[model samples]
Each structure stands twice: as structure tokens, then as C-alpha cells.
Target chain A: MSQRVPVHVEVNGRGYDREVEPRRTLADFLREDLGLKGTHVACEHGFCGNCNVLLDGAAIRSCLMFAVQAGGRSVETVESLAGSDGELDELQLAFTEHHALQCGFCTPAMLLTAKQFLRENPGVTDARRIREAINGVICRCTGYQQIVAAIAAVAQAQQTAHSIRIETAPPVRVAQDTR
Target chain B: MLAGGQSLVQLLKFRRCRPSALVDINGIPGLDAIERRDGELHVGALVRQQALLDDPQVAESWPLLREAAGFVGYPETRRRGTLAGSLAFAAPWAELTAAAVALDAQLDICSAAGQRSLAAREFFRGPGETALGDGELIVAVRFPAPAPGTGAAFHEVSVRHRDYAQVAAAAQVSPDGHGELVLLCVAPTPHRVDVSEALTRDDAIADLLGRLDPLDDVEASASYRQRVAPVLARRALRDAAERAHRRAPA
Candidate 1:
């Protein structure tokens, strides 16, 4: 048997310390070790982005990283999307309202991937860019049309909110008018 | 040992390779920098593909690296895959290998014996193979600055967007119309061809294509690569030439 290594990681805002086999994947560690089953694993390889999770705010394929490699890093999984009261976030609600998922096996990863996309590209509603952003996560269901729509809807809402905030800002007095 | 385990971890899961001990190099300091020294860009071993693509200096100067990096896997994979890791993996279809060869990048290797430098062209022996001997690790890669008024472009055709290229071409052209072309997925290693005159001569292009022994795997047939390679080479060369002319000083 291979020796187990000590791994300390922050997942979903909680710290967990465990001793696991050095070869264990982060996907397996999250599901089996921590019972955070929200992060699903389909293709053990990196081909399918089904195992994507946020490592320090950037989306990464958990299956491609060893559990020990995640030591001292912060990982955000699908479980972090909803609040403690089970209240869904804006992106999650958009997914449901737009019917972005069907079989739901790829939903968790898709959400995380989209979350990173939205964070990197603020208020970008371009369908082509959105498709490119989530291109890693292969969805056998939903045809990706709804998923693109859901992300675009959120971006559009954010853009409108930003404009409203800018318009409502206090006006600056001109020196010439004061004189 | 691993920098980015995007490929190594998958191999482990498949039981293709088993090392008694696994070394994680992600915590190593100073190995993740993308620095500019003298006239070359020195990319450390742990610099991620996405980080290289996002570097403004890379996009402004070494556009070929940026373009090729944009074709590697996807955002998530690029976030975890390192440039040195890609070169060390030496996958035949890896875009960075083609870019490195085309740009004449030099790799900095080190081991207990000491340090040495190897040109990118001499690094690859075959698929999943490199000139790196036992205990040798690639510390960084030095990509020389493109000549003044030089521009580059990378083009490839994959089964899907961001998939492994069936055949890809990377080209860089100077204002004088002299340049190099590197072809990927058309040989066991990234193949460099003389594009200084081949771009204008059909016979020269055909001669270069006739020498390639592309793989006959499931992704694409060898015949298809033979048919598509020249077209990609021409497109990349034309685009690069146009950009080079635009950047040329009056």
C-alpha cells in the first residue's frame, strides 16, 4: 500500500485536514474524503470538464490534480453556490429559470466553470464568447443553448445594474458655475 | 514529480505510469515567473498556459505563443497546464511545442550534475520523449524576441474547438519575407520546414509535405494531414506576412 500524506485544504470556506494516499485525485478526495458530492467526476481524464472546480478563484479540472497538490489552497465546489439557507445565488437561479440543465450530471461543473467565466468577463453578454468560455464542459443534454442564455441573462442584468448605479451618482459642481 | 499534473495525473489514473513517490512542485517558489531578460522572454517551469496567454508582453511581442496557447485545451485546463510541462510531455499535437520550435526557444535544464541548455528543436526525440535525462528537470524556457518588423501566426484544424489539432502550422515572417514554419501532429515531433521560399513556390510546399510521415490514428488519417497541412502552412504564412508588413517601419 502507498503511504498516506497529510493534506490541509480550504473547501467551500471550511478547512479540512486529512491523511490520504498521495495518488488520490482531488475529485475523489472531495467526494469520498469530505463527502462534498456536489463536485461530480465522469471522465477521470481531463478531456471532459465534468470535474472542474475553482482553485483560488480560477476554474481547474480537479481530476487532473492530485489531492495533495491542493494543500494550503482554497477550493470552491458546487456546494458553495447555494447559501446556508439553501437559497440559490443569481447564477444558479438563472440556470433554473432558463432550464440550463437536463440530466444534471454536468451541472455542478458547468456552474463552477460559468462562475469563473462571469467573474473574469464582467457584463459580457456575447453568445460566442459565452460558448467559448464553457467549451470545456461537455454537456450531452440541454444543447448548451439554455446555458448560454442563462449566463447572458445574468450578464445583461449586471450591465443594466451598473449603468443605473452610474446614472444615480451625485453630480459634480463645475468651478465656472460656482464663480 | 509534477508541475502541472494535467497529463501525469491522467496517466496515473489509467495506471500507465507508476512512480514510487510523487513530488508536487506547485509550492516551489520563483519557478512560476514569466520574466523578460535581455532580448529574450524567460518563462519559468511552473508558469501556467493561461498566465502566458494573459501576459500583455507575450501578446504584444510573441503573438505566436499567445495564439498557440489559446488553442491548448480550454480555459480550465490551461489554468492548470504549464508551458514547461507541455514541452516536457512532448505530445506530438501540443501547440506550445510547435510554437517553441518555430520561435527557436531554448530550454534551461538542471539536475544534480549541473545545468545545461538545449534548443527546442533538439529536445524532442519522439512522442512522450525528450532529451531530458534521468534526474534532469527543465527549469525554464527562453524565447528569443522576434526580429524587428517580424510577426507570427498559428493555425490548426481540430475535430472541435480547442481539441487536439489533427494538423497545425505555426509561421513567423519578417519584413523581408523570410521566416520559419513549424508543423505539429504531422510527425512524431514538431517538424520545422524552410518557409523562406516555400510559401511562394508550390513545388517547395509539396516537397516539404511529401516528407512528412503523419500518424494514421483515429483523430485523422495520414492522407488527410497531407492534404490539409500545406493549406494551413500557407494561411499562417500569409497572415504572418501581412502583420509583419504592417509592423514594418516606414
Candidate 2:
């Protein structure tokens, strides 16, 4: 029998200290230990990106990493996407409005993956780049067209909001008037 | 041992590897540097695959590594996968293995005994095998800069985007038309072929194809690999030569 190791990790902005088997995956640690079932495990391997989560603000396959490896690291899962009041974020709202999911097995991973992509490539509207960003997560439903559309819509909206913020900024005033 | 548990963890889950204990190397400092010194690009073992891909130096200097890295597992896996870990795993179809061999990179190995450098060509003994002995760890990999006016290209045909290649080719060419070509997923280890002569010449392609000994795997048939190997080789060579010519001094 293997020994259980203590792992101190911050998940979804809350710190947790638990003793877990060395072999336990981060995906299992989140789902079973912390009861964060939003992160799904499909293939139990790296091939299916259903178990993806943000490690130090980068997307990584949770199943491909041991829980002990995440010690002292901050992990963000799909649970972090919604607010404490249960309000969906922009991406989730776009996913719902665009009908980007069917069976929803791959939704959490898709959201996290897309979230990382948008964070990295802000104001990106290229469908090809968006498709490539989420290519790791395998979705057997919706044919990926709606997912692409939903991500594009969010990106477009973000770009518009950014430009508006820039355009509406107050003008600077000079102390000396030169007429 | 673990740098990034991208592959080792999966192996553990599948019971393919049952190590008594795992030494996590992710916390080690200075092992993730990607820098150039002594005319060689040094990539530490802790460097993630995505870090190498994102390095502007790698993209500007050793573009072949960038091209090959793009075909690795996926964005998620690459963010956690380490280049040295990939070499240690030594999967026959791993793109970085072929890129290392083609670039003639050197792996810096360390152990209790001492340290030594091994050529990438001599690193892989077979699928999932290497010359590394017990207690030995690959600390970093050093890639020598290619000659000036040289260009490199990598090409592969997978069942799906970013999937493991059925047959892949990595090539580097100089302005003088001299080059090297390495084929992946066609042999037990990366198979290097002489590409000094232009592939367009008669019998050149035939001679290159004759050197391959691909096997029938579940992903593809031996005949299928044989058929596509030459096409990829030609395309890679042509693209590399064109790049070399473009970078050539006027």
C-alpha cells in the first residue's frame, strides 16, 4: 500500500488541506475530496481534455497531474466561472444563448479551455484560432459549429466593450491655455 | 521521476509504470531556462512544451522545434508537458524526438556518479527505451544553432488535427542544397536519411523510401506509411530549401 501525502492547494479561491493518496489525480482530488464535480473525467487520460483546469492561470489536464504535484498551487475549475449568486458569466451565457452544448459532458472543460484562450488572446474573433484553442477537449455533440459561434460572439462583444471604454475616457486638460 | 507528469502520470494510472516513489522536479529552480550560451540553445528539463513554443527566440532561431511542437498532444497537454519528459518517455511517434534527432541536440545527463552529454541520435534505443541508466536524470537538452542561411520544416499527416502522426518528416537545409531528413513513426527510433541530393532527381525518392521499415500498427498499415513517407519528405525538403533560400544573403 502507498502512503497518503498532504496537499495544500487553493481551489476556486478557497484553501484546502487534505491527505490524499499519492496516485490520486488532481481531477479526482477536486471531484471527490473537495466535491467540485464541475471538472469531469472522461478518458482518465490526457487525450480527452474533459478534465482540464487552470493551474497557475494556465490550462492543464487535471487527470495528467498528481494531486501532490498541485501542492501550494492555485487551481481554478468550472465552479469558479459562476458567481456566488449562481449568475452565469459571459462565456456561459454565450454558450447557453448559442446552444453550444447538447449532452454537456464536455461543457466544463470547454468553458475552462475557452476561458484560458480568451484570457491569453483577448479580443480574438478568429474562428480558426478559437477552434484550435479548444481542440484538445473532445465534444461528441453540437458538431463544434455552435461552440465556435458562441466563443466568437463573446470575443466580439468583449472587443466592442474594450473600444467603448477607450473611446469614452475623459480628455486631459492643460494648465496653460493656447488659443 | 517527474518533471511534468503529463505522460508519467498517465502511465501510472494505466499501470504501465509502477515506481516505488516519484520525485517531483517541477519545483526545482533554474531547470526551466530556455537560453543560448556557448553557441547552443539550452532547454532545461523543467521547461514546459508550451514555454518552448512561446519563446520568441525558439520561433526566430530554431523554427523547426516550433513547428514540431505545434503538433504535440494539444494546448492543454503542451502547457504541462516537458520536452525532456517526452524524450525520456521515448514514444516512437513523439514529434520532439524527431526534432531533436534532426537538429542533432545533446542531452545533459546527471547522476550520483557524475555528469555526461549524449547525442540525441544515440539517446533512443527503441520505443519507450533509452540509454539512460538507473539514477540518471536528463537535466537539459542543448541544440546547436544551424548554419546561417539554413532553414527547417516539419510535416506530418495525422488522423485528426494534433493527433499522433502516422508518418512525419522533419528536415533542415542549407543554402548549398545540403540537408538532413528524419522520419518518425516509421521505425523503432527516428530514422535519419541522407538528403544531400535533391529529392526531385530520379531515383532519389526511391532510394530514400527503400531505407524505411514501417510496421503495421492499429493506427495505420505498413503499406500506408510507405506510401505517405516520401510525399512528406519531399514537401518538408522543398519547404526547408525555400526557407533557406529566402534567408540566404544577397
Which residue pairs in candidate 1 collide? none
What value does DockQ give for candidate 1? 0.89
True lDDT of residue B79, candidate 2: 85
Evaluate candidate 2 and give its CAPRI docking class based on DockQ: high
The alpha-carbon lDDT assigned to residue A123 of candidate 1 equals 97
How far does residue A70 in candidate 2 sit from its true spot (Å)?
1.2
TM-score of chain A of each: 0.93, 0.95
lDDT of 1 by residue, B1-250 (tens): 6988888888888899988777777878999999789989999999999987889989878888998898898889988889999999999899999999999999999999999999999999998899999888899999999877788889999888788899999999887878889999788999998766675674677666676789788889999998999889888888998899898998
RMSD of each: 2.0, 1.8
Interface RMSD of each candidate, angstroms, one decimal: 0.7, 0.8
Error of 2 at B90 (Å): 1.0
In terms of lDDT, the poorest run of 10 residues in model 1 chain A is A170-179
